[model samples]
Target chain A: MKITPKDVAHVALLSRLEIPEDQVEKVTGQLNAILEYAEMLNKVNTDGVEPTAHVIPLSNVMREDEVEVSLARELALANAPEQDNGYFKVPKIVEG
Target chain B: MDYSVVIGLEVHAELKTKSKIFCGCSTQFGSDQNTNVCPVCLGLPGVLPVVNKRVVEFAIRAGLALNCEILPFSKFDRKNYYYPDLPKNYQTSQYDLPICVNGYLDIEVNGETKRIGITRIHMEEDAGKLVHSGNITNSNYALVDYNRTGVPLIEIVSEPDIRSAEEAKAYLEALKSILEYIDVSDCKMQEGSLRCDANVSLRENEQAPFGTRTELKNLNSFRAVQKGLEYEIVRQAEVLDEGGKIIQETRSWDETKGITLSLRNKEQAHDYRYFPEPDLVPLQVSAEWVEEIRQSLPELPNARKQRLMEAYGLSSYDAGVITASQAMANYFDVVVGHGADAKAAANWLMGEVSKVLNASNISITEFAVTPENLASMLELMQKGTISSKIAKTVFEEMVASGKDPATIVKEKGLQQISNEGEIVAIVEAVLAANPQSVADFKAGKDRALGFLVGQIMKQTKGRANPELVNKLLKERIN
Candidate 1:
């Protein structure tokens, strides 16, 4: 499918990314070119092969339910832009 | 015009595991903020998540208990969303290949059993909790605690088979009981260990296609589930009656206002682009393991209810009330095992024990009276050491002091007065004091006999054996 400016804007919105209006066409074309380059796989006829979920042949990678040490509260919030009372504080997300 | 209300429920129960699903962080509730955060749970850079083995086993146990087909292969998927609760910007959930499918749970409403089809039960990670500065609408900002992040949760989705609010409640209650029976979830709504959401719509008739439905959230309790659906049915019916088209949207149950307010349109929020999670490997369950879990499953509520009816000779209603919680049913068994008669134990549990529990707002586990104490108390009444009325007083004292029944009965001098001669003297004194009542008794006022019995009971502090008092009073006044 061809990438449209509207599709680019929607993806940017969902990803919380701000795209300049002038660069919309450039981004759209760049996305379409990438998709075109990756579209060559569609021409190969391998319909009988089962879809692969992962490249590795691993399954059941798990650990026992045991509690190890967790990071200290100060260290956990060290990288946060804003914090209050040992919590990560963010802007209000009002539901419509 | 009456419309047929269609409802379906999605229940999310946090698994009772020691650690978070993908990390070794403690999943203990009510801990200090962010103290349970690990790099994996906090979605830090270059960290991989490993599944908790116990979480898988719990999911399998839940699936078998609900009579679901355990899929041999299952995998986690990334449901991409931009919610603040999810630190990863996506929730790790099962999109298509859930662990369980095609299961059904039977719920009884009005003494008729209705089977609600379980569409699927999938494993997922829970989001962190958000503490708003104020209400959601007016909050300047919100605080986030990642303690609940990465906790294992299983989402059981039901088919659109529920028809009314009562049936919906029955369905949720049954699910909770089964979950509790298998020891998977605590099912505590107050702590948010258990939660439910509903999809509700109204159609013109049974055969009519389902109208556009509204998804409801914040149904934190079983009562909220029922009340929200009931309110939604009325609201939808009104909309349809006014010739206004039903809008597909997500609504929040405003418990304080007792009304549902629209949250957001469905179309605007429906874009969750799900893709298979690559970091976690697909799960391959073996038949032997599933069998082991099935065999280890405890007797579920329905089976326990039936056994209670047969083994204890209890009525269906009594069995139902007793088996509603695994703890209650186990408590009943312990009481009976301690030499209390089965039927009598059932009665006391349903009557006085339940009354105390309700008034104290505590569970049977938290009750002051132990099973041995309760059984011995019942034995005292059965042996005529205490009258039934006196038993209640003894029970009250036992609850207050947490002492044995025999000690309480002896300490308060509340033993039944069964001696015929002693009863006769009290009876004669009562008759002489109330000569008019005696004259009335001779004149055939049966009520006078009752009044005499009351006087005798009062004189003896309600410890008189009622049967002996009745026989002795009759012979004296004859």
Candidate 2:
């Protein structure tokens, strides 16, 4: 129900974000304020209402399983910061 | 310090769809890297993912086959995680409301039918492939292939009902065959179409509360599944005996080392913050649609197994082996349809046919010998046209040349020598040459009769009608 500096740090770690140590308090306060502001919706006592995931009032928006033309390899990797032999290369992930 | 091993398998099968789950990209394997990439699959900005209709149908078909309850109202959710294989930080999967729930599959282990409860069957998109520079432990960098990203996958989660490695294997085999029978997934583990993970733990006894479990990964084969779990059980038992707690973690099966190594501990485990996927709307399955899908379902493995037992009068074991593969079962049916004796056909299929298939590492569909040809060969042996021994030689030639049984018999001069005159002369010559054996037979050495029969068969190149040879040899000796 409340955001703490430790919680903020954990969230940052999970999101792969590095927050400056001096700004942890500031970020924590900002997250709490956002949660408090959104918490106003809890004041409404409509307990019988069903939870809503989307507001579009639609279901089963789908497409047929058919192959369409795909992007060329050159175009697909055009924006890659680093690539090798038709692949997107990244830093070593040994933690898996 | 007795403990019970508890195992639950989570199997992921890539659905056989023409395109990726959300995008119109080909799902063909072994394509040039990145050729199947699209904006949606690559997680490019400003792109929306639409559900693939066939994926939902396949999920329902699997659910029905596994005896799961198909929820009319189901939706997808985003499971937040970070990995290089995932283009998006989170995987789009079903968390709370999976499409199918509370199913059960019956697996036979050691001649006893045990029902493994299915926890849920959810539809999800697969991650991309990561080709490491070396092994995961020492890889400097990894290359990513987005071709498999956004491919449709159904994750079937099982309860901790499996008590042994053999039971776990039976469960996996049953699951794979069902998926293959539904024509939903190809279920080829070598190609990564079918993958399995296990949650294993050891409790003091069956009545004890569940203990913390470790999740096993990288079990790429059925043998690995069984062997890995066996090793894990021993490892856990050792830990408990030493008063060391079993640390709940993810372990990678080091197949080369024949042991499981810890990849990460519980402290590093991902806290997947799953929330509803808003981009894709909820799926509303109608009763009519579910029924239609159910009606369209092919005869599953269990049903086919039962029918094989009843119709062909096969034993439970034989029926189980034959119906394990749909293609193999269909081949059996065609062989029977061609007027092959059911029991004889079952023996040949389970014996010689399966022997050749396993030795050549080919499937029944890829086998060169046709069911009609196999039936003809069986007929040759059954009708006394060729002895069973000669039939085997004929079968070997048919397999080598893909020729008809009759032609192989004719070309190789392998036909049974049923002619009485021909066999009588050969029997007489065998008697004359082996006069000691003849004397032994007349002096009541029954074993000598077998030796004389062997010589006669040898002289006739194993083409002598064994029954006729026995009768004629007995008449002449007496």
RMSD of 1: 1.7
**Per-model CA lDDT versus the true structure:** 0.93, 0.93
lDDT of 1 at B137: 88
Predicted complexes: DockQ each: 0.78, 0.77
Q: Give the range where candidate 2 chain B is weakest over 10 consecutive residues by summed lDDT.
A: B264-273
Q: In model 2, what lDDT does residue B142 have?
A: 94
Tens digits of per-residue lDDT for model 1 on B320-353? 9999988899999999999999999999998999
Residue B199's lDDT in candidate 2: 96
* Model 2 regions lying over 4 Å from their true place: B442-447
